[model samples]
Target: MEHITSVHNPRIKAWKKLQRKRERDRSGLFLAEGRHLVEEALKSEVQVKVIIIEESVELPPEWQVSDVEVIEVPEKVLRELAETETPQGMTAVCERPDRHNLLLESGRFLLLDRIQDPGNLGSILRTAEAAGMTGVIFGEGCADPYNGKVVRATQGALFSMHVQQMDLEEAVDLCRENGVPIFGTSLSGSTFTAIAPQDSFALLLGNEGEGVDEALLEKADQNLYIPIYGRSDSLNVGVAAGILIYHLRGD
Candidate 1:
């Protein structure tokens, strides 16, 4: 195993840039911090390029994979690459999966439109994976799923599901081709309970503040919404997503 002692090491500098969206896009890889995320990535088919661990942290015997390089770094170097207050002492660089495959999968999907908050996007993804949804589609204006905050919030779900980004209109057209009914969430739409759960469908969720786009809403086969009986005018996008996703999954 190689050891890095300086925070200014060339590799450490490059890993720090992974914190930015453009860097991740350009490099076609993202940093997975902590033992849990790294372990999950290793278990998946996603190619693990390099694993970095703080020198003081012990390496699990299971992490002794033959093909990948393992580097032990000092606390300062680990801290520079960490996004959390308390570093987990381990991180890995993993190749981003090909998202074009997301369009070919046949199952229920959660299509997010302009979800700006990383926390909300992450939580919704976690819920979608837990609910056995096939994948997630991110439309224009949505936060990047690979962002550190979003990945951390996903709690490893990032590696478990198929996630892709594209325009809402094109996504709608794809769903039409697949014979999948597109359901949009709207305040004035039908009550969610009114729509029966199905084997395959696409649920469209909109921005936190604006709800679904008017053009997309108009194209939806059906628009459904949860009844807000209490004083609160609306639900947090994540909370609303949980309610709708599980109910629609119906299993």
Candidate 2:
């Protein structure tokens, strides 16, 4: 495989376009850079259409990206398509995650209500995957889960879980129709332990400042809060979300 010498190459142009969220959205595609993320995508069954690696970078045999075009690029050219400050010298164009069409068929779900920070959303996604969450739902007012920071935060769990966006009420309604309960964190409700673990439930998290929406709280099946002893007014959204996810996982 010849290494690309020209950053002006058409393939390079198309990938650079991915730096803009609109282009990624318009094409329903996103670029995951680095050896590990691409490898994880492959392991998680994501379709990799193009992989660009630096000169002489050896690949493990099981990478198994048979139909995908594997090409080498000059380190500078690879940097041109990269979003990171520290370029990893590898990148892969992947199909956008297709978890939207899925119903919350799994009894366990995480609902992020108007959770606006990309990093928080990303960390929550990673935690959800680690805590064995069945799926995640991002409702209105939440940041785009596919945003670059969020994508990176999930590590490769973005490929490992079912994630979808929806209206808050409709998402809660979907869970309700299937007989699953929804839990939201607040300053009051039952201590996490008091609520016995059910086989299925949705853990709802709200905006960092506003807490869960009043309408959503009205709709939720259980309003629960973490018992905080610290002087701080509330926990970070990511920390709060992690606590709830673990509790539901039966901590």
Candidate 3:
């Protein structure tokens, strides 16, 4: 196993560039930090190019025999690769896993339109995975699912779910052609309790402040709202997503 001690090592510098979206886009890879996320990446279909562990940390039995290169690095070098303040002593460089669009027959789908917050996007994905949704489509303006913050917030659920990025108008058209019912959540739409959840359906969630875009809402087969009797005006986008995803993916 090779040891990397210098932060300026060419390999070290290349991995660091993955912290930026543009760099990740160019390299087709992203960094997964911490022991848990590193393990998740290995178990997942995403190809892990390298696994770096602090020199003092013991390598897990599973990783010790893996085919990928394992690098033992000094604490400082490991820290340089980590996004968090306190490092977990391990991290990996993983190829971005491919995400395919759900076929119309795929059952349940979630579409996110203009979700700008990494935390919300991450939480939604976590919830979507838990709810057993088929896939998630990212429309324009949504946060990059590969963003470090989003990855951490997802707690590795990001790797387990199918995700695609495309224009939502096209997504709507795709669903419509395939006989999947489309539902949009909005303040002015019908209450959730008033509508029936279909077995094969697509749900659209919009920006935090603006709700679903007017144009996309118009394209939905139905627009549904969660009635809020409380003084608070609206639920956080993540919270709304969990409720809608669970209810729409009925028992």
TM-score of each: 0.96, 0.92, 0.96
Clashing pairs in 3: none
- lDDT of all predictions: 0.89, 0.82, 0.89
TM-score result, candidate 2:
0.92
Model 3 earns a TM-score of 0.96
Cα lDDT of model 3 overall? 0.89
Rank order (by TM-score, best first): 1, 3, 2
> lDDT score of model 1?
0.89
**Candidate 1's residue-wise lDDT over 1-251, tens digit each?**
99889988898899899999999999999999999989988988788999999988887887657899999998888899999999998999989998776763368988899999999999999999889989888998999999999988898888988898878888888898888989999988999999877888899999999998999999889999999999999999999999988887776
Between prediction 1 and prediction 2, the one with superior TM-score is 1
Candidate 1 ranges beyond 4 A from true positions? none
Full candidate order by lDDT, most accurate first: 1, 3, 2
| Alpha-carbon runs more than 4 Å astray in model 2 | none
